[model samples]
Target: MSEPLVVPEVRRLGPARLTAGMDRWDRLDFAAHRRTHGPLPRASRSELLAVADRIDLRGRGGAAFPFARKARATLGAAERSGRAPVLVVNGAEGEPPSVKDATLLARAPHLVLDGVTLAALAFGAAEVVVAVASGSAAELSVPAAIAERGRDPVPMRTLCVPDRFVSGESGALIRAVNGRAALPPSRPVRAAEGGRGGVSGRPTLLCNAETWAQLALAARLGPDAFAVVGTPDEPGTLLVTVNRSPRPPVVVEVPAGASLAVVLDACGVDPGAGVLVGGYHGAWLPPHLAPDLPLSRTGLAAAGGTLGAASVVALPRGVCALAEITAVAGWLADESTGQCGPCRRGLPETVDALRALSRGAGSASAVRRAAALGRGRGACAHPDGVARFVLSALTVFAEDIATHASGSGCGLSSGLTLPLPRQAGERLAVDWARCAGHGLCASLAPDLITLDPHGFPLLRENANLAPWQRPQARRAVARCPALALRIGR
Candidate 1:
């Protein structure tokens, strides 16, 4: 493959007070705030909504739903006479491979808090909840920043819950805060409909941390000012996490319409490789066609990818794409909360099929089974993510799959380039041959590993375990007498 392309790292107009005065930021650390371009103005709900409509502020969360639409939805849902709406700063950076949220929470906590406060003030919210999963650096740094607000504190509270990826979703976070499992419930109830804690359940305004930071900027600079940097429809700088490329990843403030290829080139991504436009759930596109593709949602959708949370991961050419996809599928199956049947059964079936394919033992039936198993099998997008990741692998690396199946590897020296989840379950894999078909691994780690009908092991690969649980997992690993189990890196 040609040497990875060197893309220029583009900076936005100004590194305002949000990111601290630092030249750049790691995933986390609140060092100092950039000099505020101006004061924080007090805008009424309608005014803020109007500003959002004019600037076309879409949810920076991968969905890219129009901010105005969400605001209007909340406004329309409010009761005639009741407590104001609730605002939530979704600091839960659930995407395992992406670290952009942690970066904002740690470095620009104040900015995000400011945006949540402003949203609360505008909407007349009774309270603002900065929901973060426990152990996240955000849970600590953000609260400290909120505490600093003192008497003038942003009517905000902190919610530190479990760190599961789906738990970060607006509704899931709502349930988790209410003391439910950190899993998204079936059906969608906009946090706006039943206010988080009010009688009429005033609408809840939930947005990504980076989204809030941009809103803070937009509120200060006005719609026109914010629009100056990005594309007309997708205005303003988007915070993104670029990874697996030649250059170290960064939280770049890329302007909309910047060529995807140019940005990757600037970031020093491998050339002639498959690019993961979104995060793990994102599609795979060949790098050649991405050069002229714009960076907005529409642009990426046109190019057959989602701009996700701006996770641009470049997979080197030599790696087995199927193996990587299957590995991720295996992880997705592990991450399931097991509340529902489809996700519990379907995800593993999909993972097994993918594993079989990766081992070059799967035939057409295996491919069909994998595809079918991935469809609509989870409480949230976990199953869909695994499916898309697998489907894309099948399409992008068709030749590689054929070769691997023909008793040859993909001829790549590199191992799995895609970052895998690092947790207890992922650290354990069953040795098919070594097992006396023992169901002990399944019984001992029932929350994660399960027993197949044939007395073999069925494991959940992406389950996130608490740090303390590592010892127990080690015990499980040690007890596999046949030495049929191993934890992945």
Candidate 2:
């Protein structure tokens, strides 16, 4: 399958670090990459570890975990087990709206390779595996980049996995590389621990594409130089996926402490509709605090948000917030693999509650409660992520939720701003000619259908289904007494 690799529009605060050379949209070839960033340098394990510490480097793949500490733990485990470590580069970007990782793996492949080579050499890695989405452009781009570097210090191979959310989990990624199912293991295990669960049971160091790129930049710039751009505690730059929704997301580089308000204004997004600080697993920034919030992990945390994967989405005025939230929630629910009790049962119910709340028939507390049920019960972070996303939406857009639940809906259609693999656009319609006005449909789908004084089911104009509403709408159709309720295009 041929997937279109849409190169996102690029923006930068001061100077472009990650997106250094290419004056054009072309991928930076080996020659161009070397010419632009100079030759890749070598570093000892201790040297690289000190560099990570000096820069306070954090992984860019949602968690913002300290890369240096993670590296130390991996190194310690490898030494204790008398096994050389394995290096794994995770380019299996599962977030549909995010292209930050893809931007690095597909465009500036050498920059990321430089970091990979450095890490592999430092830790004496046995082999390196690069995992990308099966049909994504990275599938082609990464292998081509490896071929360019013919005589790498570490032997390299690229494996492809389905680009699903859980497929990016550490254990799941390693499993996929070893030709096993790309699902999180039943027991929790870190790649560093290297049980039989991780790739080939050897100690492994797994980090996302952006984390490697960040390391490459830090190595090239040195500590003081790298610290010049960002905040006191957090240095270096961030590869932010700025969502211009309904259009391709823009991948921008901003100094770590750059103001969220400034980034939004520069990106031409008005945050009157509220701003999402992190990607889907992240929280919505309160509208009042967005202007003052910084882009670092600490800054967002202070404002009740996490800078997860650094995706910033500013909803436009007049779009239905509830509808957009339902779209993403529905996607998250589908991605859950029933790995645990709450994750298996809670996510779907959370989506249903959110859909009803959007239609003015459910309480905000019910949606939050359903979402909270999954907070810490899953074996992985899927349930927790879903809870964080839905609960934040309920808090950040409280006014919108109140308005919708009060039946004075904003009357705006779903902007379709949040991208999804499939748009469930089916609408609920009534076969008025066959209607006996028994009001059974109203009882069945009170969120969607209301009974008029004349006992006919009333639907809003252009009553299209958000992704989460399809199940309820279908059930109402099946159970309608007069055979009056139907769902269609």
Number of colliding residue pairs in each model: 16, 0
Query: Which consecutive 10 residues in model 2 have the weakest lDDT in total?
Result: 460-469
Best by TM-score: 2
Measured on C-alpha atoms, candidate 1 has an lDDT of 0.67
Per-residue lDDT of candidate 2, residues 319-422 (tens digit):
88899898788778767666677655687678878877877888898998899887877888888888888888888888888998997886877767776776
Worst 10 residues of 1 by lDDT: 1-10
Q: How close is candidate 1 to the true structure, as a TM-score?
A: 0.81
Per-residue CA lDDT of model 1 for 19-83, tens digit only, reads: 43435533222233434334467888888888888878777767777777887767667655354
* List of clashing residue pairs for candidate 2: none
Q: Give me the runs in candidate 2 sitting further than 4 Å from their true place.
A: 1-5, 423-489
Give Cα distance to truth, residue 227, candidate 2, Å: 1.3
